[model samples]
Target: MRDKETRLKRRMEPALTPWSGTTEATDWSLPEDLLQQASRRLSILCVVAAVLWGIGLFIGNSFPPRFAGLNGHPYPWPGNLVGGLAITAAVAMWLYIRLGHARPATLDVGLAFLVVNAFAIGLLDEWAPREVRNRSVSWIAVVILTCAMIAPSTPRKTLFAALVAASMDPIGALIAHLRGVAVPAAAETFIQYWPNYAAAFLAVVPSQVLQRLGRQISRVRDAGSYQLVQRLGGGGMGEVWRAEHRLLARPAAVKIVRPEVLGAASESDVRLITQRFMREAQATAVLGSPHTINVYDFGVTKEGAFYYVMELLVGRDLVSLVRVFCPLPANRAVYLLRQACHSLAEAHSRNLVHRDIKPANIYVCRMGLDYDFIKVLDFGLVKFGDRASTRQNLMTADHVTSGTPAYMAPEIILGNVETDPRADVYALGCVAYWMLTGQLVFQAETPMKMFVEHLHGTPVPPSQRTELPIPRDLEAVVMRCLEKDPQKRPDAAELFQMSCQCKASVPWDHEAAREWWALHLSEFTRGLTLAMPAAPAVSSSPVTR
Candidate 1:
């Protein structure tokens, strides 16, 4: 009976509920709406003021003032017309702000200037002595001037404009104090000058605001995405960080924009960097081979910070590997090459060409020697073929010569940006040559000369440089890959299959090589003490990391 009760209680237990996403939505503010409202109000006031001022001019002229001819201007007609327009502007500015429309901050600033000018003219009329064509003290002018200085078409604009307007008062007072006599009309001068100062202020404000916006954008972008554990390193373009995704909790590497490569949040540079970033992600994601780094996700953060999330690789790059080990054992070299070719085959099948194929781009993972994982990195400089021309913006001409010149093909060196799979095959040949000889296929002190050699010169055979026995069949394969004409080069798919066969035959060749080396004992021994200046030992290090 107790066991039956326990079973019934266990069956009643409920499953745990998971979290669901929920957040309030906000609207995007556009500045154009505010401008329209301001313009409409200004037009109405201008029409009313023009008609009233014209009637006043005739009535006042027909009936002479009891006091004098002096008013705001030496000629009363001119003053009346100018004063009317100024007063209208003040009312129009007030109406615009009261309406509370979204508009660019410039229009608000302009409206404040217009209103301030009306008070400035009125004060001039009141302050100037009888000989200077002044009239009566205007109490109304002070109220309008104060309101004009403080009012703006929007809350953000009003606060900033008021502070700016308030600052002008102290400056005007300082100048009056410095001159040793009170300029009784100093406040009026400040009202007149406020617009000019405000114009300058507008120019300075946006930069600081944009910088703040950029920081905020960065914060938003980083929020709940990935956390940077540490910086990896940077290059000509940007820095990379070791990061972790918050949800999946997977290790990833995040790349950030470099200050040198960008000005604060430029739409153009940002777009280009974003494109390159997405291309890297798309290429690696679609390649989807174990030999290629896996891209988890990529996007720009709210803060204008661009980053890509990719599976964190632990192995050292192939460049370091090749440096430690000069020429690898023939069997081992063939095996690694075959794995790389397999990755390349997959990339080619997807219509993608890893133009920047080099030692640094290859990763050799040894944690699993039995399952030796060779990963490729930095498809950042991939050749997007026809897709490039379609872009409205082509920021730089660097793609034509993107990869290490020593490894680039003749077709690429000749400024052929429309490179194809054959260009990649040629780079593959360069890598193979480097592996066999423990040296660059073409030697030059400068990039230009190296490029010229690739375009117009022939590289020495790998066996000649390394003192290794060159099988005629292998030589033919390497030569075909390095063929000057792209058409003559074997496709990566074909070469990948060939590399498979090459690795498989290595076991059989070992037994045969023992006998063959015996017959050519003197020749084989000559390679043992080969003059190796920068030749490192056979490094298990991967070149194309």
Candidate 2:
């Protein structure tokens, strides 16, 4: 019997040899289906976010509690929500981020929808009786549902958000029905409760979020001296992960390029792109300020992927923030621009131009009672003043242009590679224009038209476009950056200094923006947004200059 058992164990040994390690097979590599599901969910969330935000703002601004329009509820920061539905969507957004799962998937669409309708129902304040509040929510749900029907490019998220709003509506209606209102068929009640029930859906919701972040984090292993966490984002080229220093638990961003991309490249080409990518990191990584994201390490993985670690930011991108409350006040605009200039100038000093300087690229780490940390990302489109030929070019990776066309300069569209700091200056001008008006400065009907406008059409200054006060210094800076002539534009470093000098009413020590805005507004007060007591209107002459 012992001999037979030994023989059997010997046969089983080969099977266990491959997976002898601690982690499971799926742990190292994600399943195809899981990836597809995550990707689809992300796409759906994108579509849903676009729709819900558009409607939320419209309903929020158009409805009662009239102050809520545009810059509605007055929530201290950006926009405020007087209605319960808008508040609910905000809560879902809050939950999404805190849990480290702000994917805004189909599930979020449904949750956002529910939150909006629920908010409108007066569930939180309940100014009137429970039944009255419920009825209000039910009515709001109808309006939300109708909007969803008319929306273009409806995805799973849109459907889900609509369903969520619908859930609140039925419950409100049911309460009214219970109070002896001549109700429709009992079939409607059964239908409301069909898919987890609508009459009281909030009871089951509110706290049921699948924060897979912990699960993702737990999967990281403590190898060597340091510990590693879950991966953040990567494309066909590379991946980035969060890691902790062994000695100090300080967090860092670890960027990685998979072996396949590096391993197969010729040594010369590999060195070229590697050097460029590293140069990109070094150029902006060590700005050495809270406003600037700090790069800690840059190295290749055991598998031969190149990686760089930097400061991991917390908070939404400026794009998300603006969608809620846009057309920032001139003083507020100056404050943000000044901080951005500080960082960009540092890059410009090294002759580095951040080609992709869009709202999505700027992250707001902390919105202290009045201040925030803005970290820039995706400098892949960076231009090195002296080094023209990059490893990316050597490989002939793809034919597509490196940067987003919307932000690309006139010189770039004309296929100018010797493009210097002026290209980035154009992008910065575009960003400044966006903040002041909450609209793209060179917006045309199509991408083709947008590109053409950059070549031909003249952008109207912010002062002329919106009600906001436009500082001449700020105006000079934007126009100079957008100058058709590259030499006519100021290098990012010079621009940064100008920004620092232009808005100086507030001391660096004084972080109180409200007081700063109030004081500065009196000097050069320009109103922002389409709402409020309305800021003073200002305009500029059509410039052929």
Candidate 3:
């Protein structure tokens, strides 16, 4: 009952607070990808605006009224100045995009140009003919409002720019009046500026409000669906929660990560991590193997937190199982390793390398009638091959240490991100050794020492490391996987086949598994006191003898 109430509170929890800070644009305020796309589109718009400005200038000067007294003038100084500002802005934006500084400074440059253009045009209106001057402030306000709407900036920034631009027209008119220019009557001047301000305010307010509303709806919708039931573990990157879908009552595990956890990382680094994370989740979701954990959904929160939900398994991981039960018999190890191999085979076929595979990541679950069902977990450190073009490689580039030191393949430790499925094969061998001998293939006091051993030390065979009798075939397969040279390690498919051929004195059949679980989980089995049904025999058994 207490747990249910906690879940209810989590469900009722509001969406995370919208990011708060000064209204001024910052790299963290919006998604980096959105900024880049908006920057490119805005750059194009600036170039187009410049082109239109030049054409309008040419036509106005070629005709009479607008440029009557300015016939054969070298250049319309006021108009040319505004035009030059537009062209300069266009060039700067183009360069900014080409140089890849768009996210941090793109909106800044755009807003600067809009404000400057408004003031420049307003100053030009001071010398226009009475007919043009009468409506000049209104025209300038429209231009400023238009530019703000199309800028790469956020709604707040756009609205701020619109307000400032609109006010400039009145300020410019006041300056002209003070400078002894042939200004309009005070009432007329007031009427001209007030209407322009009103129109600009109306134009900007609705668009910004609608934008804010849309974002709010999206945030509420995202946070409304799932309720966290219990806290799972977390690491440097993210936290995991045991959660349930409100509508379906389906249990799941959700992993959540904040963009701020990246600490001092630049926008590009954060973007790369987000991209890699999504790609990893998508790839894992499609593995199609029953042994692979399933992903249900994934998305980012309004507050820049990333999350994904996966099927929740209620069972001990191989690490805990081995720690409590000591070294597993050769038959049980064969049973578990073959299932893991099936999962890895599917991942390998999809051109994914699960860079971090260890005992903790391989789960042993009791599923319906089947006990000791294997579910491979945690593909967060997967590396996509060149063939997997849909996913971009991390910009930090894979030279850095990424996987757990104990189980990481030697090739990965040596900074080879391009290492193939064989790297995973090696890690699987380490896991197999740990399962068979109740210890890692190599033991060291420090990570560096372990890395050194994995890089240069020869691993003792599983059979030699333990008194328990491991099948010769299974030991050979495990030893081959621990080979330092990746080329020497058998691929996942071959390992699967070899595990199928391994012979053991006592095969861990379904009945044996059921009996073992009944003893280990006495309280769980109390509701099933009826006589157990006869179990089916293994056909083309993965474990022999």
All candidates: CA RMSD (Å): 16.5, 23.0, 16.4
Clashes of each: 22, 17, 0
Q: Which candidate would rank higher by lDDT, 2 or 3? A: 3
| Residue 494 miss distance in model 3 (angstroms) | 1.0
State residue 197's C-alpha deviation in candidate 3, in Å: 48
For each candidate in turn, the TM-score is 0.53, 0.48, 0.57
Best by TM-score: 3
TM-score of 1: 0.53
The numbered model that scores best in lDDT is: 3
- In candidate 1, what residue range of length 10 has the lowest lDDT sum? 17-26
Off by over 4 Å in 3: 1-224, 387-391, 395-398, 523-545
Error of 1 at 257 (Å): 1.9
- Comparing 1 and 2 by TM-score, which wins? 1
Tens digits of per-residue lDDT for model 3, 404-452: 8999888888886476788899989989999999988889999999999
Candidate 2 lDDT, 1-545, residue by residue in tens: 45643553353232221112112211223223333344344445435554665565565456646443322132322233343335446455445444545232433344454455454552222222333222322444444433332221123334455456555545544554565554446576446434433423332231112223322332232122335555555544555665666677565555655433443335554554564455545554544545566666554332233455665554446665567566776666666776777777776666566677877676644423433455666665676655554422322234545566677788877766555766877887888887778888777778878889888888888788888777787788887878877889877777777777776443333356444434533322344322211112110100000
Q: Which order, best to worst by lDDT?
A: 3, 1, 2
When 1 and 3 are scored with TM-score, the better candidate is 3
User: How many clashing residue pairs are found in candidate 2?
Assistant: 17
